[model samples]
Target: MPRPVYLVDFSVYKPPDEMKMNYNQAYTLSRQWKECVDDNHEFISKVFQRSGISPTESYLPPWVNPATCKEPKYDMDSAKKEAEMVMGGAVADLLEKTGTRPDEIDILVTNCSIYCPTPSLCSLLVNKFKFRPETQTYHLGGMGCGNGVMALSLLRDLLQARPNVKALFVPAEIVTYCFYPGLQKDYMVANAIFRMGGAAILLSNQARYYSTAKYELLHNVRAHTGQDDGAYTCMGWGPDKKGVNGVYLRKDVPVQAAKALEVCLRRLAPSIITWGQYAEAARNLFERRVLGWQVPEYIPDFTKCIDHFALHAGGYAVLKGLMAAMRLPTEKMLPSFATLRDYGNTSCSTTWYVLGYMETCQGIGRGETVMQIGMGGGMKAGINVWRALREVKNVHPAWRHVAHAPVTEADLPRPINDPEAAAAAVPAGDIAAAVKASFGADFKATTAVAAH
Candidate 1:
């Protein structure tokens, strides 16, 4: 099938629970562990040794307070409970925001990596949202940080197949649930970095949404590395106290994964570079004397080519790596850095918030391109390109600027996604359980297998 033009519409929910930290307040605190502990044994230093994030006696910011390195303070039960509630709340809010009822949504894609509840689809959302019978739903698990794009890609494909069908793509990953007590460098990075985030995007292939200037998903590209165990590997979650599963993140993630991007991009988009460029590249490869020598020649004029860049807002180093790999200027990567420094990494939904921020405040120009990139465990990377068709307007409750914003850390919210752990916990042995209880098993398991 020719690439389908999929219109992207999104809803981001940073629950009230996540607003516990002051803006960059938590990161600021976590950044001071060197003084809080011995420089050689500081938490940041251990996890990011390669980055030279050693303890220093240098000045630190006021809000950059160290996380009480004590056992994770969150109650697994409570987090799941909250996720259960927030999951539905987010969907409801999405329905209300988009002015669409549950049954109206023809295709549903829900992702909450940390928690997959019993009667997964119907239990988590369908029943609560009052959906109609036979709503196609998919639950994505273990797709890690890059799964959001996977979900969107699936939705786009489905929408293209059934042109009038409306697809609701929701990425709800809550980090608070599985956080365990331990200063292990890798785990500490997960704790210090990942937080709560839930986003519900309404997607369609309808000509109307496109004519109105929504982000149209033009293409999707996926890259995987570390599969052979050199630098890339599968990332998983383990059951902790009370059976809450906390995820494992590799420390060698950033640099190791960077090398793999070239291979993945080429495989996914054999034509990402046109024949003319390919010929030039081929000449450079075979005949050193033939290719262009100008340094700026290979670096596309990102500013002129793309109107805005909503990078994953993954982290400082990751964003920097993307800039280098893409050979983009610093200005292009600012939105991502700003988002990470302020909100920390919201995992799956981070890139969407960046897009939303651009959509609301900065305003996307007509026919401009907005590049969205996401990367995470299993050392995955997802890049889905967007094109704006009209004037993008302001949408409130957006990601606030760290320097100029009035929204405080109080705005950061903890979003949850466990339906089984409600006041009445669903039994674990409910397998052979009805599809409702096994909501995400099919898709999540399948995605994991596909990645491997």
Candidate 2:
């Protein structure tokens, strides 16, 4: 028999007011960037105005101050300090919530997309908390914001193979080193968002944990669109003209992400949707393929399958695209939007904040299903289906101080449709040429396979 994985408890890091950044404070900090002149500042302000992020969202690293506005120190010591601040808080809270000691964790997994030190995040936790030397530890890096669900999927598999063990998963992105002060518009956009946050989650297959567990891991589906040249470079860390390293997000990222999500949902729907919905989708596929009939695309009513959504709080455009593609109602999209508004894009940990919002505001009931979706730099989309095991009455510390303001579309910034909004110097033709040149014969065959 397979070991059933359950989420015993989870905690999200809440940065102090000292690190909070309002719209004016963000603009002030942007002025310190290398290429942020009056015009660039104005453009960035406009972008933030439409970014769906609230003015009161928190940014990170106690070192980031508008009054100082100095370039963040990206040394290893600073990185360690930032990790301690966020990860320590999250782990402490999670341990308290689960009533588990550090030594009780049989497996420890830590994910930080950009910062992986010699000791590794897992090792750091072990040293700080004094876990047993035999405890299993794994560190995941460069997997992007979707890594939280990816980590959960890995934990589920681990518990299945080794039953009756407790695991701790910490997902965070340290913004100190990732702060880009470059002239590249794409890279500078990251500076506008990408705040500091982290989440610590505890899972187990032990029978004792089941009664207190909040959710059960049901299914996880992942789709990687990196095979396509367009998806590969849509969002990634690269150097600018002046050799300043930073992450860049293409304007067409939402379009590329939608394509990837469509593929993932196609694979995921059959497992979660009702039998009737599955039959309809199967018929639609048969008609389009075997029957050679031009049939309309079949969209499963996901609301019937899942009661709550923990979509990634990536950005305004990304969330908008996902809401439209999945046919999610405004209320269903509120948690994601509200998370983005309050925390900005907390990278891998953003989905946890969304889940927290759902518990705090929407009130998920026992046995209700939730679909947690996330996308990241690998042009990867991940979905995790979870069923609530028990009704949670305790509010997470992160949501304790947050006001219960209802989210509305009006809270988000106005949408923009300028041609420049989608403009990029790296044309499609150039991307194709580069891919062909780099991969030679493999590029053509891979492109064909991806298209099929």
Candidate 3:
């Protein structure tokens, strides 16, 4: 049998307070950029308000903050600095808390969808922290948000191949350069939701660290629907009609994501499901294939085996799509919703934020399993299965603001991710009332400064 891999610990970067951009600030920044193109204040304001993001949700890069600048600075230098702050801070925190030296890491894996600079982030960190020359460095760029668990998959394989070694994985997205300065509504969604965040995680295969490890890696699977043209073209980074660059999120994204989830789950089910579920699936397969029952494929009850879920916080619809398809309850979906409400969509780092919420707020008992599911622009889905070695309730700085009062279902925006809400024009007042009901006093206080 192959040696086991363990997650030593992980750190989520909490941006400095000055970088926190409330809803109104984000709207102001978006309006400033749209003024040159298609500035319809009322329409744009409605979009921001109804985006399923609350008043206190996202953090902006220093250059993109309305409080710090008149307009966002989207140049290469600013992008690099943004990377340094989020990624550098996360890595530093991991090293400091774990007491692990830079040179001690046998492998370094970094991922950033945009803003991959020359010499690469891996080399930049190696030089900055002085990792040994022989350290194995891998950088994944433009792979989209699923790269967080994808990195975990990569690290798992590497640890299985090489024993007695440590690896540092950093997943982040630099929203600075990705800021859309154009007028296209499809492209502007990126500006409204994508936020600044990153995470540094340490993994080890050494038996000596097993006792201190949080979880033991069980299985990692990744699947893509890129074979389908719709999936492949669902999301892209390119220039619009006006020749202005941005990430275009297509309407078909939710559909394609559901398909990708189906593909990933099909591959992952056999490994994680119970023998009873396996028997049921086998019977379903026989009926569908041999008997021609025209029945739907079996979806095993994941809650039966998996104790916790750290799902992707890509968007309200994305989470809902996954929830509906998988038949999960609102209680199991709280972590992802809370992450989206607190940090917006942090892209590749979203799953880490979700996991951090569970660690800080919902304790994971020993021997319990955690399944992290993530999907991103590639129309890809990644799943990581881990079995906790010890009970974990450690507080994380990323969740500090809400850790004291755990996020309940009442805290999330309602009338969200529903077809009726999507089809009809939801009165702005109704949406505001829903938000007010959800947040209560906190919503009133936050909206005092955020409301236009």
Candidate 4:
């Protein structure tokens, strides 16, 4: 297996803190589950109660939710309007920075848990940038939050076959549309959590690109736990039989995840970690009774060896689980939480968002390693490790976050460009330009994605 060094994670982003859009607004507007809605101003306290979580036991930090916990906040109108520009612009900017041409791309894969573009994001890239028409492409949907890691796994495997393939992968979610008017606890939970997120990664086995790439794939492990009762447990707010609800975040998410990760990691280790630590975890599990001293289900000590932590800006609890399980310090893990609090959980693209921030603000020095942890249904758990390349040839201009943080691209909307960008360009929403750019000015076709 070829090592996949981290090149550049361009999508790590966080919305401004003052952005007025929040879950409270959606919850209040949602007439469906008014009775179940808890609009208390108690901040994180109310969220814990709603989530049925005990911070003490859960390992959640004090500053996470602050005074208010709401669903993710992104200017949907603005995001949709600029989605094309942001995606294309960022890609263009990345290509320009890396000294790579748009046409050099050999592979493309995209996943949008909420929005599946007609022409598919990959197609848009092909047409807009003139990537080879034969580039392998994939559009993944309905995988929920886990889609991002799944995309990485897919990209890794594809790159293996096409060693020179410059796989440009994107994983994003538009939670704005997912907000349905319902206040059922499940509905409310979805409304309370889940946020807009998107991430992009450039992968290749080419030796030239490898030198600048951040981390390589030491290994990847994926599992599905939402097989039965876990299926609908953690879901997004959409048109369920009852009504529009955000994702249904379940009570069993963490516990179920613990079991799945253990199984997956057992297969990936040996080189990543010593057998002794693994043995400690195994012994602890057997000796610790079901009711004995609370043993954190995960051992992140190995992950700790990695310099940075790029956990999906998942809700506070998920980050805490990894922290407590591995005994990680609060300060060290702040980048992810900070990204989540400010960015509002940009869904699948979260870890990328953090990666961007780290590069600019904290500085992702060369040779530093980062661990990306992802979770979704089936109590699924996916882990992807990255080591920072010696240098980031390119950093997207729109990569800044917060006010003290500069995310000025808010006003610079993305216009549709490059139609024949992907193998097939669907001509709706954002694909109009991609097809027009790649295929031709006259390329006219209705956009259709893998999922509507």
TM-score of each: 0.72, 0.87, 0.88, 0.68
Against the unseen true structure, what C-alpha lDDT does each candidate score?
0.53, 0.74, 0.77, 0.51
**lDDT, candidate 3, residue 187?**
68
lDDT by residue (268-337, candidate 2, tens digit) is 8888999888788889989999999986667777888889899888665555445545666778888887
- Give the C-alpha miss distance for residue 348 in model 2, angstroms: 0.5
Which stretches of model 3 miss by more than 4 angstroms?
28-44, 283-295, 415-452
Report RMSD (Å) for each prediction in the order shown: 13.1, 7.0, 6.7, 15.2
Summarize candidate 1's per-residue lDDT along 1-452 as a digit string, tens digits.
55346554566665553244442344455444443334323544333222111122111111222333322335545555556654665667777866787878888888776666666743567776767678888888767766776566677668767866678877866665545444333333554455466677787766666675376776677766646684455456664444544554543344444544444444544334556666665555554445535432232333544567777654444443455445465456555544554445666777776766666556677777776766656666667778776666656354543324532223322111223212112232111121112223222211211111
> Which pairs clash in model 2?
none
lDDT of 4 by residue, 1-452 (tens): 55443343344323334333334443344223333334432322244332211122111111122223333233355334334543565566566656777667777776766555566656766777787777777877667666677567777777666655577876766554554454444334433444434556677777866565665666577877656575445444355557554455444444555555555655555446656676876677776765476754444365446677777655544454455444455555666655555454556776776666666656667676677766665456678777666754334333443324532222211111112223123222222122122222211111100001
Q: Which sequence of candidate numbers ranks them by TM-score, best first?
A: 3, 2, 1, 4
Off by over 4 Å in 2: 29-36, 67-71, 282-293, 403-452
Query: Candidate 4: misplaced stretches above 4 Å?
Result: 1-86, 124-130, 231-238, 241-246, 274-300, 391-452
**Which is the leading candidate under TM-score?**
3
lDDT of 3 by residue, 1-452 (tens): 88898999999999988788777666556556534454544544545455456676578887877667786789999998998889999999999999999989999999998778999999889888899999999999888888898778778889989989999999999989888777776666676667889999999999987788999989888887788898898787889999998887665565566567667787888888899998998999999999999986676777897888888876665555456556566788898888887887788888899999999998899999999987776778788999999989989998887878998877776433444333123222222223223322222112211110
TM-score of 3: 0.88
